[model samples]
Target: MAKHYIDTQSLGRGPQRLAGQARVADLSRLVSDLPAQGDLVVDWSVAGRADSAGRNFVLVQAQGSVVLQCQRCMKPFEWPLDISNEVEVVATEAELELDDDDVEGPDRIFCEGRLDALGLVEDELILSVPYVPRHEVCPGNQPDAAPEDEPPAKRESPFAVLGSLKKP
Candidate 1:
């Protein structure tokens, strides 16, 4: 069985915290089965809040880092993540819409009044990746450009000059 990421749903009503480690890969999968390599130590703390509908929610502050491929270079790199996010998991869409007291953004999603913090952790980590991947220093230097206006000139080979010399 794969190791389950520590869940922190119980903390919505009060200060809650969870700490665990998972692999850097398997990030795309909803339930990541992290490899035995480096594990990302995730630490999350939530101070509960109430939405517009008076439904209780949690304000999550997560800090962690994962190894991800650079969008530009396809090379493996470490991406650090420290986010102050507020996710209001309400009972229904109407409740979320009617609630006007808190700031609503696309990050908000309606669930069955249950917060799956592990899922949220996976998503936020993925969102942190840059669209373009690039290496710090790409291999191979740029080719030297010849002067465009210069006419073609015949160049003598060093071997040809050596061949013309007669040995005594």
Candidate 2:
């Protein structure tokens, strides 16, 4: 059976609630706070998988919508995030190794005691953010004006030339 811990010590080997799925709105206090302080509402209806190696790995599968602003249109919209991630929870880099997919790697989050699902979710969402997030199209977007340096030139096509040659 899996065991839950509130400290860095590793408990007996078994299945636990390491990975979770939840619907959250604000993550300001969750991620910024070091010990990962926030409430992560796990949806028991949605099944998730969690694997650990000496308290180093925690994989979570989450699916929910996050409200974000469209970088192009400057309008807020809800973007659904289908979360399937493996986050490593560890203390030092020396103890990290790439043994399993969910094994917390060298560049992983380290916790003192309790697992902060809220902070983990926030990090995942931020990483998933697109560099250029925009809707299909917005009304505010307009065609760019031609540069002043470039001069316009008129050219007649073959069809136009043939029409000109025709009498009438």
Candidate 3:
């Protein structure tokens, strides 16, 4: 369905890997988090493999940075992106439903023929975004001035002691 779609069955039979880098703007949902395009770039990959138990899984990974306005200070800050997820692939909806209750197990998805490669990557990226965008510490934390009632803390110059010693 997508340009990057791949068949899960093929992936399970033989290990296959796909990777690429794309501008943040290319991700429809995640791009909305950016204040500006800036240098935001996403590197992503999808790989398929089978465990010793013969269970088929798709591994997805993506990393990037997004520029966002701080909910606290209203200043733009960079949010680092790191996403890594693995999901089991099932051929039928019944299998997906049966696997759904196993919360501890890897997520499961159904595949008729192929999986949407780009769509999967985009979903993972979107989940990485914070519900409320904010910086750990706002970059614009510097206050403009001292409060009206308080005087600025006076600083004693390091040379003051030397100057006193030099007094004749």
Specify the highest-TM-score model's number: 3
Ranking by lDDT: 3, 1, 2
lDDT of 2 by residue, 75-118 (tens): 76655566667655666655454454753443466665576555
Evaluated with lDDT, which candidate comes out highest? 3
How would you encode candidate 3's per-residue C-alpha lDDT over 121-147 as one tens digit per residue?
888888888889887766657558878
Model 2 scores a C-alpha lDDT of 0.52
Q: Rate the local accuracy (lDDT) of all candidates.
A: 0.55, 0.52, 0.80
Give the TM-score of each candidate: 0.54, 0.51, 0.75
* Tens digit per residue, CA lDDT, model 1, 35-150: 23265565655445554545455566667765656555555665566867666565567766664755545345666634555566667665654555555664443456679998
| Deviation of model 3 at 148, angstroms | 23
User: Candidate 1 regions off by >4 Å?
Assistant: 1-19, 25-37, 51-53, 96-107, 135-168
Tell me which residue pairs clash in candidate 2.
Answer: 2-15, 7-113, 88-104
lDDT of 1: 0.55
